[model samples]
Target: MTDRQWADWHRPQQHYLIEPRYLAGGGDIRHATEFLRASGWKDRSKTGGPLVFHNPDKLVRVVFDPLAQPGGWTVEGRATADRPSWEARFGTGTPVEIIAGLTDALTQQPTAHAPNVWAPLGTHGWEARRGQHVTAVSPDKSAFVQFHQSSPGQAHWWIGARTEHGRAWDAHLSPTTPLSLVQALTTALSDPRPVMRPLGNVPPSDRIRSTSVSVTPAQLGAWQQARLTAARTAMWARSAWTAARPRNRHPATAAPRVPAGHTTGRR
Candidate 1:
């Protein structure tokens, strides 16, 4: 291992290795082996390309790969022996203490963020708003998510995500979604990947057939004015066109209308 990789390996915190780090090919494997031995993590495999470290309980497994470059050391553990396993990766030479800390944390139940679950929206650069319910827009303003206290089909809190590009997806979720997961999802939303959602309630055609629009007196007056203006414009255009055209000696007869309250002059 190089001086920098060795320095990274002895660090106090695990933050540096959360993402992949490239390690030079030579001597890293021996360095990792010696470090794993000092940390009391046993080599699970007698023969292997990657060194696997396991605690006495075997609940946590940390894999150190000298060749894992372009990828970091991976730590896998379960909340309990019966619980599902979760994995995280670190850079080339992550400190053993940091990996152990993460392994311990993974074995515990997730912390729930409730009631004030949406409070972190602002921290992620999302603008919070109140419409029929509550909503928040992403930092870049490319996407938005709304939380409804209650809606026609849903009685509990449901949220929807939408983008300016006509992509819309929503889900019904309890307020207990883990704060960490929520943060991760919001971060992912900034990427180009689309969020998937299920179809929501659709009204039957019969119900839509009964729907009607109501127009007020003001609207009626506006409609009448628009029709009158169009009629006058059309009349003027016709007259102008006729005057510009050649006229014949014979005149055509036209019908005349009587006034509303008066008879025609010739009955």
Candidate 2:
């Protein structure tokens, strides 16, 4: 391992769950690892294809900056122009500047991790509004805003916090945070720069994180085989269960238990 990698190895971290699709372009593990490696971050886990990066001791936090807004998402200009206004009015400053200043605090890695990988914020013909949910005119729009993979389906920025960097102790949980505010904005025309979220609930900063690990051939095969076996076993069991039952009987009618509330015919 390189010096930078060693440094990153010693740091503390939070956990996050990232979508495979989000990690496709800029958010991918290879790209994030390259960036993390130059600055002393290391991939600690054995599971590959994840966005997990570890630091020596909370020395640095990898922030996921989405340069472009996905379809349906909006970025307020005046609010977003400088640093996000929340940092200013709220007195922190924009994430860009925050990360920039923190850069001097630790070793800044030089790799191809760019915001361009994340699609830039866009209005997509809808009027951009500040602090409000964007109006989705079409129920099934081709252009999908930022999507985060959840248990059942692909969700919006609210699910972005899943990409956390940390240990594999908890299976897939960690104590991490977001480097930038990649939240949803109003879909109206006259939006503000702050790009304040208007929804009642928002994805918390502590949620977004990266936890990348190196994968091995044997492990991958084992995992695949396990899943396949489980699936095949379940299918076979289901087939057997159904086949063993009477074909003509109604499924709702279970086998009768001993008769109750009956009087013997003979006295």
Candidate 3:
């Protein structure tokens, strides 16, 4: 990123927020700090304070705080076109343009290692990635899925889904969750034509509540059996209701009941 470009990235008029986990790793911090230092960016920080880098000739500056903990580091810049005085008083540009620029900067080969950050969402297109936790939204914004590893290394995957009607469902995948199943879910979520199964009206949070981090295969099997039983019960109830209902036939047009010798009609 150019000095001007970097400056533009942190323009006072713009704001950007990226979760800490995505950028908190030691490698990430080292890579970013080294990149900036090697690029001749001067460190004008005070004693025992967060590392601050700036180019005296340009309006760009970055601050890396190791003590920031969960918030990670904060970096800001401004383009040459942005007037610091004017922008500080009144916002110079929209967040969309600013975030787009940041995304572009991060996607570049050298900066890609810094962190994978997702911009704040408004109406559509939301995503966030932090370690084992990953969130993805469909292209049309009608569906969203959040995948995460509930256990540290038990090889378990929990998937949460939200449909157009706000219906939510979640399922636990085994250590051997098939790639085909994952791909199928992605395709189903991306495509709106075919209706997907297991995304019922009930929220997954309400239906599948696993107290433990890792769910055993036996537990999964038992849940499946219960679901099957519930489905059969529903079908039986429907059939019983149909059988109990009176037939829709007119009484006068129906066959007459014989009292004693009224079998002449039949003969």
CA error at residue 169 for candidate 1, angstroms: 31
User: Which run of 10 residues does model 2 get worst, by summed lDDT?
Assistant: 168-177
**Candidate 3 overall Cα lDDT vs. reference?**
0.34
Taking every candidate in turn, the Cα RMSD to the unseen true structure, in Å, is 35.6, 25.0, 30.9
Return the TM-score for each candidate structure.
Answer: 0.26, 0.23, 0.25
- Model 2 Cα lDDT, one tens digit per residue, 138-173: 111212222222444322332111224421110111
Point out the higher-scoring one by TM-score: 1 or 2. 1
TM-score ranking, best first: 1, 3, 2
lDDT of model 1 at residue 34? 39
lDDT of 2: 0.27
**Candidate number with greatest lDDT:** 1
Each candidate: what lDDT? 0.39, 0.27, 0.34
Compared with the true structure, what per-residue lDDT tens digits does model 3 show for residues 1-267?
Answer: 898776654443311121111111122233344344444457778898877776434445556554654323333435333222101110111112121222222212221121211222212233433344555543433334344456765443343333334433333434333232233333323332211112121122222222212334344446545644544454456456658874221111111111231112110
Say which prediction, candidate 2 or candidate 3, comes out ahead on lDDT: 3
Winner on TM-score (2 vs 3): 3
**Ranking by lDDT, best first?**
1, 3, 2
